[model samples]
Target chain A: AQTVTQSQPEMSVQEAETVTLSCTYDTSESDYYLFWYKQPPSRQMILVIRQEAYKQQNATENRFSVNFQKAAKSFSLKISDSQLGDAAMYFCAYRSAPSGTYKYIFGTGTRLKVLA
Target chain B: DAGVTQSPTHLIKTRGQQVTLRCSPKSGHDTVSWYQQALGQGPQFIFQYYEEEERQRGNFPDRFSGHQFPNYSSELNVNALLLGDSALYLCASSLNSYEQYFGPGTRLTVT
Candidate 1:
């Protein structure tokens, strides 16, 4: 079984500052996928970034990046120069690869608030 | 192209009643997966449908059933609903890749 955990129930960040959201997962499979999804108040889940276990390098979007410590089973999200628009409920997810059926197990979530 | 779409934006049902939620996958998508999102929590995978057949399922029991049509549209059926079953039901469409596109979701309330 694969389980993802996001320890911070809530987080706050000042606009233009940076923030980090921690996530860790337990999976026995060596090949799998990790993801960060942002769900705004509108309740729409948006993909933020994705990382593959096979890759040693981390994944980064425009303002979002992930510190994927595979050995430690930690995949954390980092938002640089945070913007108010970034405020949302963020979820961390795990999907096994070979991807044997494309089902994802998600973490509880961390609500992010951007303060101006 | 339009993204995934779910029907009955909201529904209210009593305990022991049954409910069905519909979904239309994004254009050109052939796979559909269903998820249940309780208040203040991440969405939980219920099942996935492909080629009009069930490809995979989660820990949910037979009480949570689903079907996929030839057109790639899907439906999630929950029988003998309980108050614990109240949640937002989401439908996601995807290609062979791991990335998936989600719908707005149908909010179900079991009183």
Candidate 2:
């Protein structure tokens, strides 16, 4: 069985500063994908960034980036130039890369508070 | 193109009652997946439908059932609901096995 862990229950960041949310997972599969999702008060789960296990280069989406360490089984999200709008619940997710395995295993989540 | 859409936006049902939630996949997407997200928790996978048939399911009980139409639209039906079933039901659609696009989610409140 595979599981994702987000140890930080909550995190705070000052406006325009950077913040990193840590996540780790237990998985036996070598091929998989990691993701970071953001859910605001509106209840919409938005994809922030994704990293493929096969890719050594980390994934970056504008202000958001990921530090994916496949061997360590750790994937973390870093938000640069954090703004008030960045405050939300962030979730780390894992999905098997094998065909037909479509379900996503998610971490409990970390509440991000961006202070002005 | 419109993203995944679910309705009604909110539903309130009593315990032991049955409830149905609907989802319309995004344009060009043929796979639909459902998830349950409890308050302050991450979303849990429910099931996935493709080719109008269920291809995958999670750890949910048989009381939780679903259907996918020929048009790729889907419905989630829960029977004998419990208070623990109260949560945000999310619908996601993808083309093949690509990244999924999520809906705003329907908030189901079981009293």
Candidate 3:
């Protein structure tokens, strides 16, 4: 069974600054996908970024990036120049590689607050 | 392109009652997946429908069942619901890959 873990329950970042959210997982399968999803008060789950297990390079999308360490099973999200809009609950999720199977194992979300 | 959409944004049900939630996948998507997000917790996968057939499921029990229509729209049905079933139910759509596009979830509260 694959399990995602986020150690931080709450995190705050100064506006215009940067913040990194920690995420780790346990999985026996070597091939899989990692993802970062953000949910605001509206409760809309938005896909932030993704990292394929086979890709060693990290995935970056605008201000959001990931530190994907496949060997260590660590996938952390970094928000550069955090804005007030970035304030939301960020969740780390894992997807299996098998076809016709899209089970996503998610971590306990880290609530991000953009502070002044 | 319009993204995934869910109906009955918020609903409250009593114990032992049954509830039905609906989802429409994004344009061009052929698969629909359902997940449960508890307060301050991650969304747990319930099941997925592809080709109008159940393709995959998670650790959830029989109480959580679903159906996919010919148009790829889907429904999540919960029977004899309990208070523990209160959560945000999300509908996600994808292709052969699992990099899903999500919908604004339906908030289900079992009283």
Clashes of each: 0, 0, 0
Worst lDDT run of 10 residues, candidate 1 chain B, spans: B95-104
User: Per-prediction TM-score, please?
Assistant: 0.97, 0.98, 0.97
- Of the two candidates 1 and 2, the one with more favorable lDDT, higher being better, is 2
Task: Tell me the tens digit of each residue's lDDT in model 3 across A32-115.
Answer: 999999999999889999998999889999999999988899999999999999999999999878765478889999999999
Q: Which candidate gets the maximum DockQ versus the true structure?
A: 2
Report the candidate with higher TM-score, 1 versus 2.
2
DockQ for every model comes to 0.73, 0.88, 0.84
Would you list the clashing residue pairs of candidate 3?
none
Model 3 scores a TM of 0.97
Q: Residue B47's C-alpha lDDT in candidate 2?
A: 98
Better candidate number, 1 or 3, judged by DockQ: 3
TM-score of chain A of each: 0.97, 0.98, 0.97
Residue-wise C-alpha lDDT for candidate 2, range A1-116, written one tens digit per residue: 99999999999999999999999999999999999999999998899999999999999999999999988999999999999999999999999999989899999999999999
True contacts reproduced, candidate 3: 0.97
Q: Please provide, for model 2 over B6-80, each residue's C-alpha lDDT reduced to its tens digit, 9 standing for 90 to 100.
A: 999999999999999999999999999999999989999999999999999999999999999999999999999
Q: Taking the tens digit of each residue's C-alpha lDDT, what string does model 3 give over B20-100?
A: 999999999998999998887898889989999888888899999999999999999999999999999999998864679
Name the candidate that leads on TM-score.
Answer: 2
